[model samples]
Structure formats: structure tokens, C-alpha cells
Target chain A: MAVYTEVPDDELAAFVKAYDIGEVVSFKGIAEGVENSNYLLATTKARFILTLYEKRVNRDDLPFFLGLLEHLSAKGLTCPQPVAGRDGEALRMLCGRPAALVTFLDGVSVRRPTARHCAELGRALAELHETGKGFALRRPNALSVSGWRPMAEAAKGRSQAVSPELDAIVAAELDHLEATFARLDLPKGVIHADLFPNNVFFLGDRLSGLIDFYFACDDAFAYDVAICLNAWCFEPDQSFNVTKGRALLSAYHATRPLEPDEVAALPTLARGAAIRFLLTRLVDWLDTPAGALVKKLDPLEYLKKLRFHQQANDATAFGWRP
Target chain B: MAVYTEVPDDELAAFVKAYDIGEVVSFKGIAEGVENSNYLLATTKARFILTLYEKRVNRDDLPFFLGLLEHLSAKGLTCPQPVAGRDGEALRMLCGRPAALVTFLDGVSVRRPTARHCAELGRALAELHETGKGFALRRPNALSVSGWRPMAEAAKGRSQAVSPELDAIVAAELDHLEATFARLDLPKGVIHADLFPNNVFFLGDRLSGLIDFYFACDDAFAYDVAICLNAWCFEPDQSFNVTKGRALLSAYHATRPLEPDEVAALPTLARGAAIRFLLTRLVDWLDTPAGALVKKLDPLEYLKKLRFHQQANDATAFGWRP
Candidate 1:
């Protein structure tokens, strides 16, 4: 299930040599993801996560992914900075694939976070989004309408579980979104497309660091907030816990009060986001390889999310009341 | 991005030989999904969708996927019926994969479904769950708690552009999700796993057909209804559109009112649905291949939906006051 290439110890050692930190004393592959292979490398002076270039990752986009990490880290964001290689570069070739080593963050991710933690995450997400401005690169939202339908096509005809009504709803929602959000004056900037609960790490009630920059790209700032609202505030059963939802949103608002335009466009953004997940999950569901340790996620989950977003009109539920 | 194999004309013809349907004069690939390869097959007697099996589908589970189609068709559920091949089998080898032919449905998905449509679809979904009993096959929830951490691990250690607070929130949420709802009374039954908006087609405010059944499997029935609530209700934005939510849930309740046991589990089911989406979208965000038309959806949208379900502790939002 390791999607990406595994970073080599020797290569990571070479990158560590380039850093202003310490000597590489240890390194090992952490076989976990379906994207990039990672190794926890400990140097004489510091710890780092050595990443191997996985097939799914675009080598060309390494600078964007790694550089953004450095940029955000330098801007006082509590993120792991990608270390420059021997060529005085963050991007480098390793094991015949693009690879890099990042500063190892402290503390394990909280397996159980409270409402206070949710609120803190909300505010922190706002801060990171605020810092993502003028991030030196411009990329369109990768999961926009133009990007969704095609994926849905890949998994078509395999599963009869997806009601055609759902497909129609997606098509119709796409059109509505195009018309509805086409005119919004929402501020545009870099946003984290995947702000799920596990992508973050906390040290007690305080946040230690944020990991996984693979989905960072130019898009709406509010979208990032919405993602956070969706990720951090849910109850155990996956329902929207208003107490946590409000706390998270309120924290986010306090840090970077949403612009009226961004606030207004939330419903549509929510739908767009929902459709995006539904399609990806659907594709995954239909294409899970045999003997793959990876579990196929239910596409219906996001379908429901999109359906709810479709019905969403009260800004209050989002805890961003006018 | 076609995830599966293409069904050949000869193969389509072979598969339809035993069915009561007419000749398959033509079959054209409907290049849309990333899960399965779908072809619009037309014959002198009827039009149908010829699906070629791909990796995500298990050959052993073909009976469930194919049989459910036939079963629903028998019950007058607006679904595509599986056509047997010359060998007297609904599933046959074609294009080096398992393939089947289904009667193509009539009517387009509604762009702007009326409240009645929402209610009707909800009721239909409930009825489908009711009828789903004794469905001869069962599969556990594919995107349950056991699936979350692995997905998170996939995206971990990859430079995130998130703030410390955001990281903490994610860690905390993961913990909470793992601790709670990790185990619950799962009223197992056949439930459609991907009931998105576009999967249903409507003709004049009535649900003409419910297409796509590849993801139908065993799980909590209320979770299915919760999925409907999330999908049928909600607007494009993240706001809760109570009216539509009400109509959809009410209509569903009218046909197959939720059991108190089901209602008790609604909150958890909603959360499960939300997390199911959050994880898949997160994985996609981290792993989409280059040149793959698939887009990574925002994980937060599900996070928001989860939040709403968390808030919906009572049956009011679900339109089930009883």
C-alpha cells in the first residue's frame, strides 16, 4: 500500500549532510502510505522524516510541495521544513526519484481531541491559510468541477450501488456551482485540500505541528476553513457536533474573520468539496486491488456530505453567522 | 482514467444471448468513471450499459454486485437488470475481465430536484433498505475506524502547510474518532454505499431510476438513511438548508420510518459517513497520479457533514420526531 517511492537511508544521509543540522545516525523506512515512502532519520543533531519519491507524486511539483513547507515553516507556522540537499536545493533526485528530508516534528498526533482542541485547530488553520497568501505559486483548485467528473468516469459501470440519481445530482450540482460561485469576489490564495484529523499533531491542548503538504495549492481561503470545519469538529459517529463546530469556527473567525464573499460562497464550496471526495472515494471503491492492505472507503459517505452541502443555506450552522 | 476494462461487442453479444432482452447491435464506451469501464450498448430490442470488471471489484463478490442488480430489478426498484450470457450466467469473461450487460435506464438526473423529489428519493432509499433485507449477501463497512489510521499514515510525514494549532486539532479529532464509535451496534443489512446526487434520475419530479450499485453492501441501515439526509438535503454551500433536509428525511420516514434503535445510532452513523469520506479524500489528495484526470476532493466537506450529523442528535433534523 505504499503509494510513493521509499526514501533511501544513504540518500537521506546525503541530504542531511547538506543541512546546517547534524550527522545522520539512523534511518529506516516507514511503510505506511499509498503515496510516498518515508523514513524516520535521526542525525547527530536533529531528527527528520526522509521521504522517497512515490510514483503518484509529480517530480516537477517537488519544489512546490517542499518549498511551501519551508516557506510556511519560515513564516512561523509550526510545520516541518524540507531540508536542502547537497546541491543547496530542497528538491533532489534520490533512488532515481525525487526525494527530500524534512525536519522531524515532536509529539504524536492526539488520538482523542476535545472541543477546546477543535477550537484551537480552527484558529490554527485560519493562521496557516492567512500565511499561505502570496505563496509564490499559482495552481488552480485541483478538485474543481473540471477535475471531478472525469474521475467519476473511471469507476463507472463497476458498481451499481451508486444510484444514477446521485450522478444526476452531481451533474446538476456542478452546473449550479458554476453559476452560483462564478460571480463570488472571494479572496483567492493557497489552501490545504486535505485537512483531515490525522494530518495534524497535537501536544496536549496545544498544537505541535501540521504534516502532509501534498494537497496544498492555490484556491479559496474559506475552502480551507470549511475543510477544517469538516475535519476537526465531527463527533465520534461522524455527525456535525455543533459545540465543537462552533468552537472551531469561532476560533478560526477570531484569527481571520471570513470576508463576506468567502462566507457567502461556503455552501457551494462545501458541495464542490463533497463531490470531490465522493468521486475520489468512488474511484477507490471500484478500483481496490486484490490483497491490498488498504481498505476501500465508502463513496456514499461523501455523497451524503455533498447532499447535505446541497441543502445547506443557513450560514449559522457553519458557525459564521452574518 | 477508466479504472476497469472495456467490454467488447462480441462479449456483449455473448452475455446477452441467454437474457430475454433483444440484440446488442452496438456498444460504446461511456467514458466517465474511474472505478469501472462502462459502455452504452444498444440493440435492436433495447439499450443497456455493458460494464467490464476491473481491479477494485472482487471476482468472488461478483454475485452481490450482479445479483443485487437482478434482485432490485425484480422488486421494481429503478435499477439496471443484469443480463445473462450465452453460458447462462449473468457474469462472464470479456476483455480479459468479468463483464455484464444491463438495460440502460431512461430519463436524466434532475438539476434542481423539488422538495417532493427529495422526499420521494428519501422514501425510496428507506424502502430499498427495507427490501434489502434477506439480500443473500453481506459485507462489512469498508470505510470504518480500522481504515482511518492507515490512510492518515499514507499522508503523514509529507510537509504540510498547516499551522501548529491545526495539527493539534487533527490529532485530537483522530483520537476522538478512534475512541468513540469504534464499536457500536451495527444493524447489518444491505445498504447502498454510494448514493450520491447524480446516481438518481428523475422524470417530472419523480425518481425515474436509481443507477449504480457496485458499492451496495452490508452495514447499518440508519447509516444509509443518514447518508441520504446528507446527500439529498444541504445546498452547495456548507449551510444547513433545513427545509430540504426536512423533506428528504420526512419522505424517507414515511416509507420506512427509522427504528428507535436506528435513531439512537444516527449520530454515530453520520460521523462514520463523514469520516469515511474524509479518509478517502485525504488519501486521494495525497496520491493522485500525474495526468490522471481525477481530482482530489476537500476532506473538510465530509468533516462539515460530520459536524452537522453530530448536531443532529435528535430526529428533528432528520424529520423523525417520533
Candidate 2:
């Protein structure tokens, strides 16, 4: 739940006047994006999302993010389109922070995703990758292979407190993934690196929209698939849901068929995805004090998933028989 | 920023089935009301607020609160009306907590309210009090003068930690208020005891709606005005803005004239109002641990307001000639 900055009424009214949208009807601080402050802005014309970028998001990267959304929306993906002001600029300053208004999409995010939802997500992921071709901007994934070791080193001392075996397991996995992960030649494009279930919205069984493109960057399309497989195929008990994995992969394959090289790299990339989240969560858990408002997520949850990926060396183990 | 309960998609869909409003098009948890979990639920018909009552609000008082809004709306006051489900029941269970849906009002709450806004708020407040008449159900004001002593006692030990002169000031003021607070005969009706600037919404100096009725109860209407004077008439520096006070009072009087006794009792009521907020804030300040997510308000701010009201012994001090 994030509403880091409070936008005053007079400032907001003046800010909205820059755009051609009608006078503000209703505005509310919404608990949406975690990295910035978001307000559900309703005007006489339409409803939109007004986001104030906080310190977590780099100001220089705003153009890339907004441009990608525009590019994807033009390419027929259901995503937020940045609404430019009368001055032809979407990014401006409001409340001493960079802000932008985007068209609001209508859909409710599913909490417990079914196999059908997974299939929809898979097809949507493929569509996003295919549509992302020829975008001028390029942002390398910051939390990729090069970012893992530094985070693991930072959380090394306190990882034992989270779990007795966490330090050993992370160290061993880091060595293995660094040598093998993402080594194969595969398709590269703009991948939504963090396509978790909460980021995907659904209306009944149909996928309605995908949101929170903050973590998107240029990475292997197959790596994005691996991230989704790690994120969507795990049950509450840390057991692998092979049916969901098969549905997700087959749907993606039907949209854009995966090469054999990409298929063989799934387990290693999946393990790398697990490490990426585990290290970040480990650092957060170590830094957050007890009784803090933001609940600290257990890093060991990903460790359990990592253990399964370590044993599954082939695509068949994930129910993806290409 | 309260979103305590996580209502799953299946539960929310099932819950909305009982209502005839339409299928949910979008749902986002909103950072509104402090006491309950509020979600901005947009459906095919129109937007509505889904409130899941948290533990702070008593379960037994739900009907009285909802009934008061119904009565006020029927009397033509702009407020959220409770939306009944198919069975004609407004309140139901969702995610193991008592919940209700209310029609959404379109307005923006002001951060720094001008004198004009205060005048508009005064008229709307008077309208609320007048409309509150003839309501069958009744609920007592729990945070009235009777509730002050216990709270002050709880914060007495930590009072010195907050300020060097805090304990003595509170003790003296409590004794004085115990004798004169709410003793005079005044017009009694349902009062919005927490008519702070944020609780009232506006669109270009016109009052669009009033909200957060959890604090509404049967009490002296003049006392409610005193709460507003304390809440709205003070500048950020804690100085009383007599101009704003005059605007608020005169506008309210124009809507529903105040009796002579009510005018005479304004000073004591305003002083008592200051103490009421001062004690509650003091208790919250002492109880909240450092580094908690919810920001703790400074009790000394209200102390400054109380000091100003202490010297203001007559209604003329508030710029009301009557």
C-alpha cells in the first residue's frame, strides 16, 4: 500500500489544467504502485491514474517507461497509455515530484489464479514480447545475473537469522546460476521482469489488462517466461503446480513458438529468477525492523522453490514438453 | 491508510452477486477513512465504496450509523447513501468482517481550506444537523466530555515526556472544563463531531459532499460547531484565524440561527473541544512506538489551540457579534 506523497487540491487543480481533460470531479490517493504515489483521478472527461514518481524510480528512465507503454498500446496490448498535456508532455512536476497521468483500465486482479488464468498470462506475455519489437529505448535488467551476487553478499551475514541453511543454499546456487543462467542464445526483447499474479488483471476467465511496468527492461524473452513460471506455478505449500506451468508454457508457445535452445535453458533461468527475488527479499528482511508497518516477506519461500528447480534439469519437469 | 483485510477475488465476486448494482469492472483499495478498509469499487452501473469495518468500530453501532446516513440523504443532504443488497440488507459479511456498500460521491478534499471553503462547510454542517432531525435511531457520542478524563489519565504519566508544562496544563484545563463544558441548555440534534477539513469535500469553493460519519452522534449542535472551529479555524502555526471562524459561524447561523445560550456557551465548548482532541492525540502519541508506519500527530499543536481558546472567554473573541 503506497501513497508516499500527498497532492494538495489547489496544486492538483492547477496541474490538471495543463491537460485538456475536463475539470477534476473526484481525486483519491490509491494504494496501488509500491514505488510511487498513485491517485485515482476522475474528471468530467474520464477516469485516469495520476502517479507521482518517488525516489525509488529514476527520473531519467521516465521517458523509456512512458514510451514503452505508448509503443505497446499502439501495438495492440492492453496497457495504460500516457496522456500528454496540452503542451504535448506527459511527464511534469507536481508536489515537487515528477508526475504523469495515464488512462485508467478497468479490471480486477485475481488473487488465486487458476490454470486458465495462467494460460491467458502466458499468451499475453508472448504478445507483449512480440509487440515490443523495434522500440528505440533499451534498459538492461538491473536485477539480472550481474545484480544477484552483490545482493547476496549484502545479505550474507543476516541470511542465517532468516534460516539456518539459507546462507549455504544461496551461496551454492549463486555459484551454479552465475556459470549457467542465460548462457544460451535466445530471443531478446522488452520483458516485464516482474509479471507476478497481482500485476495481471482478469475479468472472470479472460485476461483484461497488465499493469505496473516499472520493472520492465530489455532481457531474454525466455527469461521473462522463466520468471513467470517461477512466480505463477508455485502453490501455497511450495509445491510445483505442473498443470499450471504446462498451460502457461503451451499458451506462450502457441503464440510465439520457443526455440529448442530456449526450452533447454528454462531450469537454469528459473533458478536465477528464484535467486533474484530471494536475494532482494533477504536484504529487505534483514533491513526491516520488527513491528514495522511494511510486512517483511520471507525469503525462504523462494529458497524452497529454488530447491525444486535445482533438481528439475529439463523442461519436462515443468510439464513443458516441447 | 487502512487496508487490513485482503478480500480475495472469488470472495469479492461472490459478495457482489448479492447486490444488483452490476458486475465489478474495477476494484482498487483506497487510502481513505482511517477506521475501516475502503475500496473504490467501480461497476458497470456506477462507482461505489466498499467498506470493511475493522476492529476499531463496534459491530452493534452499524445500523445506527447507516440509518443516520439514510435519513440525512432522504432529507436532501449530500452524503453517501447505503446501498442495499438484493435482500434489502445494507450490511453483510465479506472476508469475515462486517461490510457495506455506499454510493460514491465525486469531490476532492481540500488540504489547505480557504475562508470561503470554511463558509461552505459551515452551511453544509448546519444542513446536516437540520436534516438529522426526526431520525428514529439514536447513538450517544462516545468521545464526549465524559470520555476525556480516562484518556487524560492514561497519558498523564507520559505527559512530561511530551512537554515540560503538559501535565499541569491538562490538569488545570480538565478541572475548568468539567464544571462548564456542555452544561448550558442548547439546541440538541445529531452532530458531526469530527467535521475536520478533510472530512468535507468541495469542487471550486462549493461543498460537494460530507463524509466519515462514524463520529456522528446525538449531541449539542453548538458543540459540533466548536469542534469545527477548533479543527478548521486554526492556521498551521496554531494561531486562530478569526476571519475563517467568523465565516464558518455566520454562514452556519444564516442556515440555522443559534440561540443566545449557545452563543454564550461557545467559549467553554470550544475550550472543551480543544481538550477533547488534545487528550486523544496525547494518548495516541504516547502509545505509538517510534518508527511505526502510521505517523503520530503532535499533541502540542492542540495544546496551542487550547491556550488560545483559554484566553477567548466570549463568543466575540471568535468574531461573532451575536
Candidate 3:
């Protein structure tokens, strides 16, 4: 379940009724997250998803979560539009929890994303970020410099393999990251913090929609690009898939060419991004959920990935050959 | 906002009221996850984290997360133990969510962990895994084998960075990972799936506590070691931290020596671990929470990390002299 909150069916029905969409047909629980409770709903008008505000989600932030989608969608980005309630509100109380209904996207999440796909996503994401500047709400970065250290604190132990040199390297890198990226000139805007493959829906070879805007917040635009380079261009062995990297960057560049400063900051930002996930995932891994099909993600994977970024010397390494 | 959940204060009070150790304090959210909602509470007698089973939390699998902590704690591993409710059940219910309160650890997470810290973590993890055998429960490795393909599928079109050359390399590496590690001799047991820095807490120079055991599952023990090499032993720029790496591996070995096969598989396993995180994180990045504090992590860093591992011909690359 991506949503950890529990909302009864009847309450969900009432919640949907508040929305201006047509009619509700059926709704059932679709457990697919290690965090929240998500349900797929088929309305007479269209299919939609109903996410209950779960434990991993704060009820107070529902407006940002729901409003961001609405804001982005309004700006012409193809994303889920949150349904407002009877009082012209996007949020509603369901089963004693905060919940909302969103338009169900039609395209399937691409499994075989191509260079073209990456480029398209890059362009689309840049446009989204640019347009998001006009959004009615504002949110601070969720995984910025502040969050990284605390997460590292969470995964300090539980390692069965220890290497002194390894510790020194990470410490040095952290210092470098703190010092270097601290002063880089980069664009700051609303970024889709979690720009992974599964969140993007494609119609054929084209990116049809972007889903899951929960991590959207104000941060460096280059960070998003770096994140895309990492997410779209990496293979299962943690190696840089240059072909994919080039395509993603090219597409993004077409939309918004990266400034030299942003490009220069890529390596360090990349490390910071890797460390952010490694720490968070490690913390999450150590603490399992009571009942769910979610699996513990390996944090070390990001650790090694961070190491790779540290040694990278060429922009071409990320698959950009120009 | 650290904890994404709420364990009703009264329900938590009722559950803890029966505990033999101490007084029950109000339950409060801990707010530091993309998965579970954790709460820190004060009992008249002790401090504990009250976890409300979130959507991602499985009520049935409560034993694995809760039990492992107890088991590890029992064996002198510093970690939080699940507190049973008045009903003789480790799982409790509050506000319609399955809940349990775990012992509050008395240590802060280390910000600048040293090689000695890595070594201590390695020993503690090895001890935990070694003593975790023959537990009353079992869980399959969810992130193993079949998981990769699905992630690759989601990333296909978007992996523009994966040139044909890299694709071939990645494909070959995956095959090698399956074949090379297939027949390796190693002990299997419940291991901490995520051994990053934050999960383990420290009291000054010594290791004080480990928290968050959500991803603890049955798998190869050395995989945990490989995970550490990838996590605790790396510099931010992906450089190998020898001092910390040695300390970590040495400590782990002292507790549980590695088999030759496990040693041979170390590089590949480390690579595989990197890939695992790269894929999952990439997937998540694409589907970032619509309105949550969770940040989008970098995937490029891992890609670079994988490349380094691919070129790594010596254990010393990981800061290990052995």
C-alpha cells in the first residue's frame, strides 16, 4: 500500500461524491506501496485513484499534496487532478481520515523507456518545474541538505561489513559535498523530487502522464536533472547506461539546456542525491512495517552508486556525448 | 511531520498500561520515513517509539519486524524491542491501525561516524545475523532475482542513458550475478536489509542502539556485508573509505568469518546491491509523493558507483586489505 491510511468504502464513496466528476462505479484496495494505502476506482465517467491519508502522510499537508496536482494539471502538465469536495474543497474526511479522489491516468507506466522517452520526460519535467513556479502554494525541499544528515544518522549501525578506508572516503565526500555544492549557481524551483520510472505513464513511446506528486517541493532544478540522469540512465548493476543518460539529458536540454554551473555541479549533487536515498532507505529498511508486501530496499546500493559519481570525470559518463 | 502516522494516544496508553516495565506516556509521531509512521513516547518507566501499523505495514507479518527486534535485542544487539499489549500480543490496535510500542533507545545517531564506528557496526550486525538462525518465522527475499526485471521494465524507455554498449554490459553483469552467486557457500539468516548510517544510533564513541527493523528478512548473511561495503565504506564522491571499510569488515569477520565463495561474490554482490537501489530509487523518483516531505534521490551517483565497481579489480578498492 502506498497510502498507509485506512478509509472505509462507504466513506470513500461519500468522498468521491464531493468531487465534480461523473459517477463512481467501483473502488478497491490496490496495495502497492511500502507507505500508503492506495485504491483504484472506476467511475462511470472515468477511472480514478483514491488515496487515504495514511500514517506516512500528514493530514495537514493534504492541501499541498492535492493542490500541487491540481496546480500542475492546470499548468498543462498531464497529471492526476485532485477532486474537490461538496464545499469546493479538494480534501474531505473519509473513514475518519483525510482522503481525496484523483483522475486515473490511462497510460501504462513504461517498462522499456527509450532515449526518446528520457528526452521527452526531461523536457516535460523542465516545463513542469517552470510552470510550478506559478503554483499557489509553496513547499520546501523534502530531501535537501537538512534531511540528508539526519537520515545518515538512522543507518549508522547494522552494517556487517566495515572498512576504515571506506568510512574515511564517505566522510571526505560529505565534507566535499557540504563545501562544493553549497555554493554552486543552480536554478531553484518546484521539482518532482521522486522522478523515478514507475511514476511516469507512457502512451506508446510518448510520455502520457506524470503520477505521484507527493514529493514535489522547492529545490534546485539541476538536482532534478541529476536525479533523472541517475534514475533513467542507470542499469541494474549500478553502471551508468550512457545511451539512456544521453537521451534523458538531450530531451531535458531541448526543453531547458543545463547551465554550465548546473552541469558542473552535477557530480556533487549526484552524490548528495545518492546519499539522501541511501540514508532514508536504510532507515526505512531497519524499521519494517507491521503488515505489508513491501520489501526492504538495500541502502548500500546507493552508497556504491555515490562512490561511482565521485569518480566520474566526464559529462559523457552520464551518456551526453556532445 | 517526521512520523507520517498517529497511534491514538489513548489506545497506545491502554496497550502500554499492561506492560510490566513502566508507565505509559502519550504517543507522538516520529516523522522520518517514506514508509511507516513511528511515534516517540515516554512511559512513566521508560521511553519508547509507538508504531501504528500504516498501510504499508502488514498486520500478519507483524512478527517479522517486531520479533526480529526482540530477538536481536535479546542477543545483546542494541535495538528497540516491540512491547506486547495487554492481550498478550505484540501487535496492538489504535485508531483503527495496528500498533505497537518499541523500547525507546537512549542514544543519538552519530553524525561523523569513524572507522571504529563502522567496525563496531559490522560486529553488531554479524552477531545479529549469526544469532538470528532458526527463528519461528521466514520471509522470501522480495528484492531478489525476479524484482530486477520489473524495475528494468519500468525504466526501459526512460533509460536513454543506457547505450547499447552499456545495455550489453548491464545484461551480462546481471547474468553473472545470478550464475556466480548461485552456488556460493554462505550462511543464510534474518539480516538487516538496510544497514545505512541512520538506522543505528550511537552513544558518544560506542554503538548505543539500532532502530527500524522493517526490512529484516531471511537472506544470505554476506549480502548484508556486501551492503555495508557499499554503504558505510564509501566517500561522498564514491571513493572507497579504507579506514572505515577495514574497521567494518574486520569487526564483522571477527564475529562471522566469510566463506571463500562469499568473498569471491563480494564484488558482484556489491554491484547487484548498487543496482537494486538504483532501480528502486529511480522508480520511486519518477513517482515522488505528490505532497510528502520525502525527497527525490539521485540515481546517477549509483550509476557511477556501479561503473567503479565494474572496474574494481581489488578488494582494496572497497578499502579492504583482505
Identify the candidate with maximal lDDT: 2
Residue-level lDDT of model 1, residues B1-322, one tens digit each, is 2324534334444566667776544333443345777766556677677778788877888888888888878887878888775566888767688778777775445444567878778877887887777678767766767776776667566416322233344455577767766766656688887787667865546676787877788877777777776666666676666777778777777887767777777666666677677667766766765444354567667767766776776666655566
TM-score of chain A of each: 0.90, 0.98, 0.90
Candidate 1, residue B254: CA error in Å?
Answer: 85
Weakest ten-residue segment in model 3 chain B by summed lDDT: B24-33
Clashes of 3: 108
Off by over 4 Å in 2: none
Cα shift from native, residue B306, model 2 (Å): 1.6
**What ordering of candidates by TM-score runs from best to worst?**
2, 3, 1
Which whole-number lDDT from 0 to 100 does residue A142 have in model 2? 92
Winner by DockQ: 2
Q: What is the Cα-based lDDT of residue B157 in candidate 1?
A: 60
What pairs collide in candidate 2? none
Q: Interface RMSD for each candidate model?
A: 26.4, 1.0, 21.5
Question: Model 2, residue A172: displacement in angstroms?
Answer: 1.1
Candidate 3 lDDT tens digits, A1-322: 3345534434555566676675544343453334566666655576667776666666666788788888888878898898776688777667766777787665545444677788778888878877788777778876777666666555455433433343445556667777876666688888888888777866546777888777888789989888777677667788777778777777777777788777777787787788777667766766755343355667677877887888877566676656
Off by over 4 Å in 1: A1-20, A31-33, A111-113, A162-165, B1-322
Which residue ranges in model 3 land beyond 4 Å of their true spot?
Answer: A2-6, A161-169, A289-292, B1-322
For A184-213, candidate 1 gives per-residue lDDT tens digits of 557778777887766776654677788888
lDDT of 2: 0.90
DockQ of each: 0.01, 0.81, 0.01
